[model samples]
Target: MVHGGFRVWSGSEPDFPRQAEQVRSLLGAPDNPALLPPQFVAAALTGIGGMLITRSRADALVDAAFALPTRDPSVILAVRHAANRPGATRLTLVARDRPGAPDGTLVDLPTDWKAQESVFATDSIAIGEPGSEHAKQARQLQGQIWQSPPDNLYPTWLYAPVCPASMSLVALHGDRVVGFLLGFQSQPDRDGTTVLESQVMGVDPDYRNRGIAVHLKHQQAIMAGMLGIDAIRWTADPLQAGSALLNFGRLGAFSRRFLPDYLPFRNELNRLPASRLRIEWTVAGEDPRTELSQHRLHLRESVVPGTTCPIANDGPMDLQITPGNPLIAIEIPSDWTALQQSDLATARAWRTNLDDLLLRCLGEGPDQYLITNAVIHRGRVFLLAEQATNNLLRLYS
Candidate 1:
C-alpha cells in the first residue's frame, strides 16, 4: 500500500527476517549496507545499532562517510523489525517530508513544499468559520462523511447566516473543506449556565488521524468559552473506541447518560440500535488524565475482586453490582472494526448488551454511575465509572 509517498510492503513467513533481507536485496540494497541508528528514520529501537540503511539519498548519491541529515528520509531495510509484530515483516520505502527537530518542532518549510510533500503535517490546515465562500463545501463535506440523504442535511443557507448562539467551525486544507463542527448554545440549565450543543462533526477520511478533529473541537471549546459558555456537549457511538478515547481520554469529557437507539437508523455506519453515549466536555476543566489517575488510585484502594466485568461474546452478560464499591470497570472490544468484520453477530450482541448495561448503570439519581475515564490496556478497552455524588458534576461544571 502507498501512503503519502511511502510504499509499504508486508508479508508473514516463518523466517520473516530472512524474507526481509531478501526483499531488501531485491530492492537494490548495497553490498555492505551501512549500520544506521533508529533516530534517522524516526523510530525507537533498543540495544546498540541494528537498522540497515541500504540507501540514504534516493534521488542523488551521497558519500557513505559524510554526515547525514538528522532526520531525512531513506530506503531502510529490515530484519526482525521492532515496529511490527512477530511473523509480520514489513519494509518501508518512504519519500515523505523529513522528521521534525529534536525539540518537537517542524522545520521551516515553504507552504507549497509542505503541501506537496508532507503526509500527516496539519500546519497547512486553516481552522475558522466557513464564511459564504466555503459554506457550500462544508455542507457537502458533512453530507459525504455522514452519508446522509439530502433531505436530512441542513440547508446551505442555514450555514450562511451569522448567529450569536451558533458557531460553525470548518477545517480547510488549501481550498478544500475537509472537516467541520456545527454547534449552538443550549438553553440555560437550573444552575443558570449554558453549554454549546455540538450536534455534528466529521473529518475527511483521507485526512484523519492528523489531529484535525481534535483541533476543531479545541477551537470550538475556546469559542464557546468566549461566548460565556462553560461546556460543550455531544453524543457519540459508545462502540467507536477511537472516538471514546478522544472524547473521554484525550478531551477531558465525561459521560453520565446513555441513549439506546438514539438514532433509529440502520445505515452502514450506524449499526442496529444506534446507541450513543452523551459526552460533556467542560471548556475549562482539570486535565482528564490527572482525574483518571486519581480515580484509579481510589479504585486501587477500594476495588474488590468482583468489581470488573469482563465482557465475553459467547455468553449472556450478568453485570455484578457490588454494594459499597463505588468504582466499576467494564470491558469493550479494543478493535471494534476487526470484531465487526470477523464476527458481526458478536458485535451486535455487544451493542445490545452494552446498551442494557450502561442504561442501568448510568441511570438518573443517587445510584447512577459516571464514566470518569476510558483506557486501552493490553489490547483490551475499558471504561472506568464511579458512582454519582452530589459534587461529582462540579468537576466539569
Candidate 2:
C-alpha cells in the first residue's frame, strides 16, 4: 500500500504558494468554487500530499454538500474527498441533491450538529453503497489509510462495479463520507478460489469510534455471504491493541500467520514495523459464530507475561522467549500510535526489536506461525500463538 506525492505548476511558473493558499479557502467554500476558483482544486490535486479534515461532522457535511451545483438535475447528493490538504485534514465535499429529495430515509442529520475537537461519529450514522462518482474519494482515503501517495490508491476498476469483482461500501453523515470498506473476490489460484479478500478499509480521522469501522467490516461480510462467498481473509497490524480487540474479541476472526514488513512505514502516523497478522472469517453455514466462538476458546490461554517479550519495556516484567509451548504469548506496547508520536526514536527501536523477536519466535519464512488470539489486560497487549498446528482444540486442555 503506497501513495505518490505530487509537484504542482501553473502555466510556466511553479505557483505552489498561491495554490496552497487557495486550497485553504476552497475547502471551506466548496459550494462557492467561485469563492476561490476551480484552479485551486486542480492545484491541490497536483500539489504536495495533503488531507482535508473538517473541524466537525457538521462542517464536513456542509463542506461536502457545498459541492452540489444548483443546475445539475440528475445528480443526487455528491460526497467526495478533496485531494488538497497537506499537513492538514483532507476535505470532503457534498456536491449535489438526491433524486426526489426523499427525506427521513437516511440517518437523520441534525441541523445543529456540533463541531468536534476530535473527528469521530456517534452511533446515529448512515451506512450504504456508494456510486461510481465516489471512486476518486474512496481511492484517496484508501491511500491515506496506508499513509502512502495518492498514486498508490486503488483504481476505479476495483470499486466502480465495472469489473464486478469487488464490493465497496461507505459510511456517511449527510453528504459527508465518514468511512469505507473494500473487499474483492480472491483470484483463482491453482486450487481455484472460494474466498473474498478484504483489501482496504479506513475511517475519517474525525469520524472513528462508535464502532463505525467494525460495522463496515460486518456489512462487508454480510454482503460476501449474500454473494455466496465462503470466506474472507485480511491482514491486521499486530502492534495495535484496539484493532486486535475488534478483530479477535468482537469479530472472532483468527490467525497464526505473522508477516514482517508487509506494509512499509511512511508518514508520522504510520511509522512502525511493517508486521501484520493474517485474519480469516468463514462466512457460510447456519451460524458462523458457533465455530468462531469455539476457536476463540482454543486460542485463549493463560499467559506468563514477559516470558516472550518481543521488546524491552519498563513494565512489571522483563522476559525471555519460550519455545515448544503448546500456547505462546508476545507482548506489544499499549498504545503504539501514541508511542510513535511522543517518542519516535523509541518507537523505531521497538520496531527493530519486534523484527528480531517476532522473527525468532514465529519464524521468518511464510506460514511459520498461526496467530490464534490476542488480548489486552493489565495495560499490556499479548498476541497468542502456536506453531502451525491444526489440533488447536486439544492444546486448550
Candidate 3:
C-alpha cells in the first residue's frame, strides 16, 4: 500500500470491462477505434490498466456542463479504453452532430466550443483546492515522494493556508489524494508586479504518465489568471529531461538563469548536485500551445536538422563551444533517474558538462541566451536556446 491513505488499485479492478464500456457509451463511441485526443490515447494504451473511472464518476467530471444555460444533452465528457492496449484509457469531450437521429455519430468536440474550462478528469481524478483532510493526504504524499529529513520537510498545513485558495491544488482519485501542487504569491518586484512561485509538485508513482502533472499546471494557470497574476515562476533540475520538456516544450516557459547548488541538501532519490534552471511562464500572453508549435517550426527552418549536441555512449559527452552563435542545442539523458541508478559516474559527468555549458551560454551580458524549448528528434533529446534578438523569440515576447 502507498502512503498518503491512497490505495494503488490493481490493473484488474472490479467490473473493469463494464466500467470501460460505460465510458465509451458516454462518449457515443459506437466502436473503440474512434478518434480522440492523441495524448489521452498514448497514455491509456501504455498505462497499467484500462479505464478505472466509473460512469457516475465520469459524469461528475462533466457536471459543469449541466450548469450552462446552453447545455446540450447531446454533448458530454467521456473516456475509452484502447482496444489493442488492454489497460489503456482515454478521456475527452464528444458531441453528437445529429442529436435526433438514432444512429447519430459522436465526433470530437472543439476545445473552444462554448466550454468554460477543460476538465482534467482522467481516470476519475479531480483537481481542486485542498480542505483540512485533503491537506493531510497531500502532506503524506509529499513525504513519500521527497523523503526529506524532518527539518527539510515542508510545513504543508502551516504554509498552504497562507497561499491563495486556488494556488494550492490537490488531485483526488475518489477519496484518496493522488497528487498536489503547492505555490505562493511572490513579493512584489520593483515594478510592484507579483507572480505565483510554484514551490513543488508531485504525483503518485502508479499514477504518472496519465497527464496528471500537465493538468495540475494547467489548472494552476487558470487560477492565476483569475487572481489577476500575469506570470508564474519556478525552478527545476536542469538535468531532468522530462522537466525540461514539460517546462519549455509543452508549457512554453523560458529560462535565462542557471543556479549551481541551488539547494544546500541532496535528495536520496537523485543524489546529483542540486543545480537548477529558473523558468518564467507568461500566463497572460499568447497561448502556450500556439507559441510552442510556432517556435518548433521556426527552429526547424532556421537551424541544422541534426544540431542536437552529441551524447557519448560511455563517459561524459565532449562539450563543443560555439561562441557568438545565435542558437545552441544541449542534450540531456531522457531518463536521468534510471541513468543515475545504472551508472553514477556517467551521470555525474553529464551534469558537469551541463554546468559548464549553461553557465556560459546562459550567463550575463550580450552573450546571454534563453533556453526556450526541448524536443526529441530521432530518439535524441535536446534543449534549444537562443539569443534574445531572434525573430521567433521577439514575437514570443
Candidate 4:
C-alpha cells in the first residue's frame, strides 16, 4: 500500500504470512528461520524494521512478527512501534556482546563527571613587604655564608635590590626553609607594561608536599594581576620536578631557551647542579593570562659538546683578562673531549683557567660575575657573564 511495498491491516490477516515470507526472503533468510540468541535476534529484527518502515510499508505484519511475547521483549516492541509510526526511530542498543554470551557487556557512564579547567584563580599574598612575618622568618633562617672572606661576613645578602618592601617572599613551614619564592618587579615588556620576575625559589627537604608551593604560586599570580602588571616572568631550575610542574604545568608557562651551567659560583656553592629556565606568563592576550612559561637548559650537551673543546689546528691560545674585567675569551681545542674525558694535563689546564677567572671576578665584590650563558659549537665553550664591570669570578677566594 505504501511505496509499492506490501500492506497489512491486522496480525490475523491472511496476507501477513505472505508479507513475512517476503521480508524474510529480502533479508536472505532460509525457508525455516534459525533460532538466534535473543540479543542477535533483537538486533537483526530492529535493523529489518528500520529498513521496512523507511520504505513506507503499510503492512503491520512486520511489526507483529517482531513483537514476540517474551521476557526482555522491549527491543521487539520498540522496533514494532517504530515501523508503524511515521518518522519514528527506535533507540539503538550498543551492547558489547550478544545474548547468552559472557565476554563483553554494556557500560553506563556517570552523569556527574566533569573535567577541570587548565587555569585557576585564587587569593593573593603580599611578598617581600615590610612587617611581613614570612620574610622576617626567611631572613632569620638564611643559610650561613660559606667560605666568607675577611671583608664578607655571615648572613650577607648574596643577590641584591635589597628592598624589604619591593621583594616578595613565599612563606614555607617545614624543616629549614623547604619552599620559598623570591621575586622582584622588572621593566615592562614592549608595551610599557610592568612585570614581576621571580628570582629564586627554595624548597626545604621535609615539606615537599601539602601543596604549599601551589598555594604560594597561586598567590603570586593573583598579586601580579592586582599590581597592574602585565606579565610575570621567572627562571626555574629544570632538575626540580615540583618547581617545573608549578611553572610549566599549572601556570601554563612554556620553555623558550636554555642556558647551560650558567652559574660560575656553582663550584663555590659546592657544585650545586644549576640550570636556567626562562618562563613567562602574559596577562593581556587571553583570560587568566597565557604564555610560554618553562624553558629547560641542558648543561652538558649545551655548554660543552662531546664533553670538551676540540684541539684546533692552530693549538690553544693563552687568554688573559685582568681582575674586575668583564670577560676573558679563550680559544681552545674544538674537538677535544670533555674535562672528565680529557687527559689529566688537558683537564688541569682548563681547571686552572676557570680558577684564575673566578678569583679575578671574586676580587671585585660579593655576588658578582654570574655566568649567564654558555654555547658549545664544534667543541668550543663560549661563556657569557652577567656583569661587564664588577666581575663575579673574584668573589670566591
Question: Which numbered prediction scores highest in lDDT against the true structure?
Answer: 3
Candidate 1, which segments miss by more than 4 Å at Cα?
A: 1-122, 287-323, 335-342, 364-367
| Ten contiguous residues with the weakest lDDT in model 1 | 40-49
| Clash pairs for candidate 3 | 44-88, 44-89, 49-87, 50-87
> Model 2, stretches more than 4 Å misplaced?
1-122, 143-147, 189-193, 285-292, 295-318, 363-369, 393-397
Quote each prediction's TM-score: 0.61, 0.59, 0.64, 0.35
Per-residue lDDT for 1-397 in model 3, tens only? 1212212222355643344344444543433223232222222211211123221233342210100000122332333333334233333433422111112223332222111222457778888776656766776787688775443444333223322212577788877879888765554445745566776788988898888888899888887887777678888887888888889877778888888766555665558887789888877744537755666667754654244333222225655654666677777788887888788898899888778778777844575678888877667677887776655455555
Angstrom error at residue 274, model 4: 3.5
Models sorted by TM-score, best on top? 3, 1, 2, 4
Off by over 4 Å in 4: 1-133, 140-165, 172-178, 267-273, 283-397
Best candidate, TM-score: 3
Q: What is the TM-score (0 to 1) of candidate 3?
A: 0.64
Tens digits of per-residue lDDT, candidate 4, 356-379, equal 444344222443444333444564
lDDT of 1: 0.55
lDDT to native, each model: 0.55, 0.52, 0.58, 0.37
Error of 1 at 53 (Å): 70
**Model 2 TM:** 0.59
Residues 126-214, model 1: lDDT tens digits: 88766655666776776687665543444343243333324677788887888878764454556855666776788998889888988
Angstrom error of the Cα, residue 46, model 2: value is 29
Lowest-sum lDDT 10-residue window in model 4: 151-160
